[model samples]
Target: MDFIFFDADGRYFNFLCLYQILYKPVILTIFSAMQTMRWAFMLCTISQLDVLIYNFENMKELVKAGNCEINEAFKDGFKKNIVHHCAIIQFVNTIGRAFGGQILLFFMINSFIICTTAVQFFSIPNPLNNIMELVWIFGFLFIMIIMLYIDCYFGTIITEKGSQISMTVYCFPWIDLKQDLKKQFIIFFVRNQQDLVINASKLIPVSMTTFRKVMNWTYKGFAVLNQMRK
Candidate 1:
């Protein structure tokens, strides 16, 4: 009976080891790939916005150089550019709708992870004895912080670039153009007066401000946990 029990236990241990060695890595790899794709999508959106801004800048240069003739063709091209701007805004809104929930969850989870990791790192009694463990913990903490920063950084860029459009439109020589074109310029300028902002689940604005708040909350939670431990 004792020999049979030992064999069964050994098999169970091997099964768990195999699951950990094989299954966990595969699952983690899939998750990492998904995250990479999501960020890539965000970057693609930003690049599109950059292209729109570049076009606006080119238009401004043409107007400044007195090369833009106020004719039917110019009017048609101007209207098309406004339409393109609206299309880009729609694309941004679509991205927010698709990824807002995921972004919210990411912020929540990373905040908890950061707080707990900090507490654990500080709680360790013998820093020199468990060097590898310490390194692992620090690496994870760094990655979490970096991920948060990247998200917020991109969000900031989007807001800044979007705001730049209004200024670019303002710089156009609208006063010297035809009355109809002046009206169109006014409408476009008024439309762009509001800065573009991406919100998480339509609740949290995903900018540097949010990033700072998350870090502050994490620090507060870490302090509280340390106090409880003491």
Candidate 2:
């Protein structure tokens, strides 16, 4: 019994040492590549956020006293728009969250298979090695996958919101049926008309400027996430 335990412990230590020898270079390369991707995603995302904030602040600077009344009018108009669309937003957001979860699960399972297969390739040098290699690969992949999704979402939202907000700024009194945004909103989202009415009631008290900001955000959020999924 003592002899068997001694052999097993020695083998475990040997495997540990082998892991240290083989692990760093390959794992570091993968990590470095992933880090580069994450950094690029972050830079793009941050640039978009910075642009949005810059434009929003610039718009704030341009506000005059007479615009305050227009702001109230906008508030009323935006309130109605939101109430008409709030339910639809809730439904869309719910679907988005559900689908996002599903996609994440798929990535996790897919990554697991890839890592498991990779472990087989790694074991060619010492075919009899135990399960520790797989554990490390999976641990590393899981962390990277999380990073991937976060960066992806950030990049998507910033770009989407930035462009959409800019467009909204250019077209404030955009109540025309001929306009693209209102047309789509009416067609795709106005199916839940009661939801829009309820949403507008909640939005009306906050002022049109506030509601417009939120609507812009919601619009951009959908656009960003949709791009990310693509």
Candidate 3:
């Protein structure tokens, strides 16, 4: 521990002590706010994915009644669901665009933090002396990874569920419907052949593939730091 200054009386003040006394609470409060925001983002993303999955199931159920008897109500309901699905996709994309920069910045900073923390952990001379500090850094790094994974996981689910809509349409009892209705259904199915993807500002997609890339970047950074330390 280094002293910041010493008085004529030989009394010393430490920067770390000042940090604990005057800055720790502020830092903790900022971290708390960030964690809250992340939780809200995750909740909203997952809810949208759940809505998508529910709509897919509804479509599948609609087609299960294979009596060529899709009532007006059922048709209306299906149309409404299609609109609802579109709305969800739009909502997610809007959010992705809005937070893309923030998320990208967070991941970049997190990668650097991981690299530095790993280097410190490996270079520490006395494990017992800094064990608590290492644990704190590791805990934060783990939380960040988990949060990133969750965001990617929900986005992947949304993509998969959206794509599954076409499969559900294919499994429908199109042979039992009137020719006109069958043609309309075919058009709808064709429109849905392409999957809905939510991208980060239309750049990187939010998926496991991106998550894996981020982790790889972190590892590469850590290795580079280790080499530099030598």
Candidate 4:
């Protein structure tokens, strides 16, 4: 009777363990899906900007080659490009407003996670004996770093492409254009002189510079943790 009761208890414990093991994968799957969606949205926005940049470049080339005729139709095209540019900036601003808070939160959480994980991994006395543990921790760290990098990389691309628009317009042979067209070109040039940048919560500009700062903070945090452990 005692043996039977012990076996029954062991079986119940095993069932609970199995349930937990199965549940974790489901949660990870949901998280992975969400990350995929976020990346897809970012890529879509980048592609739209790329298309607009291409249009601007093409127009610049035509103007430079003296193929562009400065007439009413040309004026219309110039105005249209300016409107399109403004529309894209507005769209980017909308995205920034919508996801700015979430982006800031992500950066904070990832920085903390990276610092803590690095400290814990480095603090282990015998990593060879704990190969599986090391691999799991390393994988988590790598994923966080990659995710943060993707966000910053995309932001840098946006800034570079945006600034290119001003350069393209500036290179156009505006001196040969009619008085009115030259004035329009000057306005466009001045307007685009400010590079487009996406900000996090209207505070932090999301760029490679921000990425470097985050890494610096992460290192500082890791150093502090190590000192505390010692």
Best of the candidates, TM-score? 1
Ranking of candidates on lDDT, top first: 1, 4, 3, 2
Candidate 2, 96-130: lDDT as tens digits: 34334543443345444444444443544554474
For 136-228, candidate 4 gives per-residue lDDT tens digits of 999989999999998888888888888877876676556767888888888788878887888889989888999999999999999999999
Tell me model 2's lDDT, rounded to 2 decimals.
Answer: 0.44
lDDT of 3 by residue, 118-170 (tens): 78778877878888887886787788778778767866876776776667656
Collision count of model 1: 0
Please estimate how well model 1 matches the true structure, expressed as its whole-model Cα lDDT: 0.81
Better of 2 and 4 by lDDT: 4
For candidate 1, the per-residue lDDT at 85 reads 85
What is the RMSD of candidate 2? 17.8
Q: Which regions of candidate 2 deviate over 4 angstroms?
A: 1-30, 65-138, 167-230
Model 3 ranges with Cα > 4 A deviation: 1-42, 48-68, 71-74
What is every candidate's alpha-carbon RMSD to the true fold?
Answer: 3.8, 17.8, 4.6, 4.7
Q: What range of 10 consecutive residues in model 2 has the weakest lDDT sum?
A: 196-205
Q: What is the lDDT of residue 118 in candidate 2?
A: 41
Q: Each candidate: what lDDT?
A: 0.81, 0.44, 0.69, 0.80
